[model samples]
Target chain A: MKLQHYIGGIEGLEPSSFEKKVFVQPWEERIFGIHVAMMGLSSHLEAVKSVPTKFNSFWTWGHLRQGAEGMNPFDYFKYRYYEKWLGGISGFFVESGYVTEEELSTKTEAYLVNLEAPLPSGGEPAIDAQIIEYLRVGDTPACDVEAQPKFKVGDTVTVRNPPPVDHCKLPGYLRTKKGVVDQVYEGTYNYYFPTGDGVGDPMPIYNVVFDSHDIWENITEPNTKIYVQIFEGYLEDPE
Target chain B: MTENVDRETYSAARVRALESLLIEKGIITGETVDKVIDFFEKDMGPFNGARIVAKAWVDPEFKERLLADTPSAIAELSFPRGMAGAEGENMAAVANTPEVHNLIVCTMCSCYPWPVLGLPPYWFKDPTFRARAIREPRKVLKEFGLDIDESKEVKVWDTSAQIRWFVLPERPDGTEGWTEEQLAAIVTPESMQGAAKVAVPA
Candidate 1:
């Protein structure tokens, strides 16, 4: 099992920081913007109206999370949040043949010498506009399918134990546990792409609530309830 | 926090290089990164969430609609566009009452309500927070200086699916007659995340 997947209920780790800032490092903001821009310009985004940009690859949060989830468990915890983003995203550009490692490293060396070295300028303003447009008019995954929900509100369902994949939406701790459906969401939702386990197609998502004692037993706090939005694919009739 | 000094410089340079190369190759513009950052500051941020919560506090009808259908209720507001944008297509708000407190966490990756909340804070993204908060939310909240009495039920909402969840922190006392702007000013991001409570200035 990937340590990344089973982060919930793991013991002994202390709270890192109450650091309130969204971007801890100034450089983190740049990488975050780049990721968003990539998502906006992603070739697979059906809702976007398209822009004149050469970023032809299919990129999304699924692709980025797969990179981070694929890292060594120790390495995953060693790096800061955006630090992982920098490594994963830069690697994507390289692996996709958008840029070469040699070129990136050489530019790195040049910038190290002069941190304020001016970035090479000039590209279409349409590219930036499209990226912002994606932010404004998001590509929602809600589909036109009539609800064919298997479980209704108050149904006690067990989370299916699908074979673990690199990235999964099922919180590892919730697997095999029984939860009561608190709310059957209004309509169907679709993942951007199918995560090998069971998610990705148009299906109902449920707000399932579990007693903390049910999942963690005596170790959990008293009078605690955990509510999670889970895909219908990852849930089943309790065995 | 003894991070490698050269590694920090390397990362800074590396990201700059990535941006520069992307611009050079016509993948994104030189203005792309800056404009994206500006969007968060101007269009989407904690400021928007504060406003939503503030309006909810004053208008029980709007608050009722918000708790029932998050996107539809939020759409009624006059905030900048994109209330239902990226990471916010399906949103929900769980209200904090004296008996039940709500905390939002993504145990796997930091899944957050970006349009309403702008971005996940550094604390929310930390692995330790993710790991511990799911199982021991009361303890985690206590560490953050909010001693949630054992009598109060703590509901930790994990945003693992399409739905992005945020807390509708109870309006603080002595602010009954205040305007929406005054109420919004007291609502901090942490409070909206259920880590703390909105307090009137001491």
Candidate 2:
């Protein structure tokens, strides 16, 4: 039970702030942009072929989340949101041999000395074009195959409490809870890779509605209901 | 000499270094990160979502379509080239009404509708918010200064899988004859997330 997976319904947390800024610090904007570039140019996309580039590793939200999931549970909470992104992403570049630890450290030290230092300019226009094109078309998870949904609207189902893995789309609170299928989504969706706990193959997903009391009993607010879109692999017919 | 550099300064320098390195290598251009940021600033953001909500407020048929099918309804409007791009590939909308209200959250990580709502606000990504929203949305909303009467149904949409959801906030009264542009001005990103209501300026 990774503490990260069970964020929902965690007991004794402080009232959260309603900070509306997308990036609290200007630096967060840079890391976010870099992550988007990585996703757009990842080797998995056909769009990557349009640009002549040396970056040829499959990267996606799944990979990024996997990195966060792999962190020490305490460290996961210790870092601010984009701080984690900066760490995971830079680590990825080094591990992938796209850049070296020593080189990055040297550059970082240089920037520390003179924050106004300009960056090296120029690369293929096709690189930016490909990244922008990705933003336009997007890498949709919807596969062409028909979903053959097993459950239908109003069918009662139980969320499978699968064994723990590094990462999961399943909310920990929803595991072992029962709910009714509200909608069998239009088509089969595939994850970037198999999650090992059952989801990842192209399969039908469902919108399941759980009554608030059913999930948290009497501790929840009145007239409250929770709706979660769950992958089929994380759900069962409730034996 | 620099053992105690503040968190922001260290992170800022480190990311600049990484971006600099990626550009030096053939991985990405010097222009790549800037272009990516520009896309969000100009083309994609809460401004687009405001327009959609405003239009839905005036056009009954369009509102029905938006509630019935989100992506298709959004395509009807002339905005950026990527209304269905990035994290918004499969966007869904749940409208708030006098009888019911909706809140969107991602308990695992923040999976948001980027093309429409842009990047999620800082609070939306906070773990405390994610943890409490599913368990006690009404309480969470109260903390955010939104109060829901017990008579109303509070629907918390947890974006746990393929679908990324956002709220279609109800239009506030007292502006019946307003233009869509005027209505859009009052529609806030916080309102669209169900954390607060769209208020008429006093």
Tell me the DockQ of each model, to 2 decimals: 0.70, 0.86
Mark the 10 consecutive residues where model 1 chain A has the least summed lDDT.
A43-52
Off by over 4 Å in 1: A47-50, A237-239, B1-5
Candidate 1: TM-score of chain A is 0.96
lDDT of 1: 0.89
The pairs that clash in candidate 1 are none
Candidate 2 deviant stretches above 4 angstroms: none
Interface RMSD of each: 2.4, 0.9
Candidate number of the best lDDT: 2
lDDT tens digits, residue span A1-239, model 2: 88889999997999898999999999999999999999999999976876788789999999999999999999999999999999999999999898999999988889988888998899988989989999989889999988578899999999999889977989999989999999989889999999999988899999999998999998898888899999999987545
